[model samples]
Target: MQEILDRAKDCYDSGLPFVVYRKPNETDVFGVFQSNDELRSSKDFTEKGFVFAPFNDDNQVVLLQPDEVWEGKYQTEKSEAIKDINLDESGKEVHIELVKKGIQEIETGRLQKVVLSRKIQVRITKPPFKIFKTLLSKYPNAFAYFIHHPKVGTWCGATPETLVKVKDKKLKTMSLAATLPFIEDETPKWGNKEIEEQQMVSEYIGDKLAHTMERLEIDEAESVRAGNLWHLRSEVRGTMLPNLKVSEVVRALHPTPAVCGIPTDEAQKFIHKNENYKRTFYTGFLGELNLRSQGELSLFVNLRCMELQGDTASIFVGGGITEASDPESEWIETQNKSKTMLGIL
Candidate 1:
């Protein structure tokens, strides 16, 4: 475990690019350290490297060349809450206003749903690797990673939503949305808004994949726990069409309704126009791409994530908004979502 992080630190110190990650429900940690410092882009998605995509595809899909690889078995140490997590909800009003606008868009039939997010920048009291250790330890079922590049800086996250996982022409992904504070031993009573919000994402994914897949199957939606919160989740799997380009499938689902909204382009326009800040790679997906031996692709949405710079950790949280959404409740949902990262901090 120490060796995996040690090599990552050495790579970062040399201003090179690397990604040290542990997949969900796995006991092994993996690292991809680029031998050079070149800032490479994977536009065609054929690159056999680590992919770091941005919310808007207009930005380059930064690829960390898989020059050196490391794998190790790791034991997770439970993260203890150290900081009094009083997040700066100063943007609460702005986020609520954005939610209101989304509702209006839905009411006027411009969009069926929209996912809006806000940032909370908090100071850190620990080193980057220490924080990553806590995060990697805390979420045993979340895809945890510490990725650094000279051009892209540093990003640490334990994402719950998966964009895609492809191997041998078989692909699997999930529609994950709607958040609530998890109460131990209690079944989450999901309301209509939450159910419909998740369903919209599932249907959107199914419809999109219909054209890209040879056969598709979607499971019933269920409640799943991701750290301190519960989310509505539905697994979707299919057989990819023979010779279908990986890039084509990724483009079909990059900004799914779970992250963007129904009528993706219109909601994306709303997000870009009203969010008032560059999301960068917050809601984007990142993971292993094109393992030479297995020809695999495992990617997860960049949720419950933060960008680390100096002593500050900029956390990103968001929720899906339908016509039935409440502004105050949405803000609180983000607050609950932020706690996932804040707890480790």
Candidate 2:
């Protein structure tokens, strides 16, 4: 464990590309160190390394060529609460207005739903490596990773949403939506708006997978907690057709109703027209592709994450907005979500 940490620090200090990650509910930690500073792209998924893809398909998908791979087992450590950083009031107002606009579109029947997001930049007093370690200790149930590339910059996150996982002929995914603040020893209650929103995502996933899957199964939705918030989630599994490829499964699953909206294309257009900021890698997916000699893949949505640039950290948060959604309440939901990353800092 100490060797992995030391090597990761050396890679970071030398400005070389590398990715260190641990999957949810797993004790094993994995790191891939690239030999050179070159940034490579993976279009066919034939390359053997970690892939960092963006939300938009037009952008390049950065790949970290594995010059060396290391694995270690470590016991989970308890987390300590860090001070909360206050969000900019002006920025909150702007995000609320964006949500209102999305609601108006839904009401007019132009779109059934659209996910809105805001990026908050916070000044960091601690080193990024320490924050990365804190994230792993705090979110043991998340897909946590720290990726650095000379071309793409440095990014880290502890994501709860699994976009897709493939091993041999089997494929698995999940539809996660809705949000409520978690209280100790209290039952989580979901409003109609949340229920409907989560359902839309599940149905959308089922429909998309049907095209390429030989057999598909979906489980009932249930409440799952992540840090200070609780979300409704449903698991989806299937056996892929022989002709289907890894890239095809990713395309069908990513930017689902949970992150994009009910009708994928239309919702994406609205976001591009109004969000007022580029999502970049915020809602993007990242993980190992074709790991080892065997064909096993694990990819996750980029949530509960931040981008480190010098001393400032840009935190990303978003929520699904429907016709019944309230602008102020949605704003508060994002604030609660941001705490997942903020508490580690």
Candidate 3:
């Protein structure tokens, strides 16, 4: 860690922005990359960088350069706790209460879609980045990210959600996801509500990208079940502008309505005010800036994340709250999401 930190500092001093991270569950090899003007790929893993899979199901790695590497340490304040938070509020008043609140928001026009999150505290000293790397190498579909700063240590997740993807001036994005626990051989059916929710997301993204790209191609996406929940997902592809920086596109589209909310500013404000937690980097996006190629950035929402504060590990979880969304069901959804990593613990 010290060696990489020192090297990153050197690169920063030399005016080169870089990012460093480790895949979940893998050791000895960490991801590193130096920013370039365009996108490229690497077959040889000599230069430290991230290895990304081409498709969602491809368990391949893509080497990337980061702008910063962060290592986080949790610090607790001196305060007496009131009550013990439940690990999975599958059947509880809290779940119902949250859904009701979301309904109210919908009725009042505060938001069209809002993503809610919760923090889970586990007891352990193992660095989360270490586990993150393991997941990366093991899950071909999983993605890993870690952003280290002096004051903040933020890591990445092995999420299947694609905020956006670009190659050879061809751009693609997805409306992913509304999730429930994955059940085997369930026939992957999409009810009216699920399909409608997914369509909303797809249309929103397509409209958002329409002016920037030409000839958009949208296809019917299927349902993707993760852990204990299922989400509605769709893929939207198009051609990029002749001169559009991958970074520019990323900045324009990150913290999407799927993760944040529609009228994103209002939804984010509500979240900060009502959620009653410092999300730090929970829903933020992090990935490689430049890989074996130039102008390529792979960033994923910081979901399924846990923070190591001393001997305590706090895992974060949340769900999208819509007008049609029930607070109780939303809460249960989060509980189900928590089970994904809690099982590992």
Counted clashes in each candidate structure = 0, 0, 62
Encode model 2's per-residue lDDT on 153-250: one tens digit a residue.
Answer: 99998999898989987988998999999999998989999999999888889999999999999999999998788999999999999988878888
Q: For candidate 1, write residues 233-311 as lDDT tens digits.
A: 9999899999898888899998989889999999999999988578999999999988554458998998888999989
Per-residue lDDT of 208 in model 1: 89
Model 1: which residue pairs collide? Answer: none
Flag the better candidate by TM-score, 1 or 3: 1
Q: In model 2, what is the error at residue 239, expressed in angstroms?
A: 0.5
For residues 286-309, write the lDDT of model 3, one tens digit per residue: 554444356554456666665555
Error of 1 at 276 (Å): 2.4
The local distance difference test score of model 3 is: 0.58
Candidate that would win on lDDT: 1
Pitting candidate 2 against candidate 3, the one with the higher lDDT is 2
Per-model TM-score, in order, reads: 0.97, 0.97, 0.72
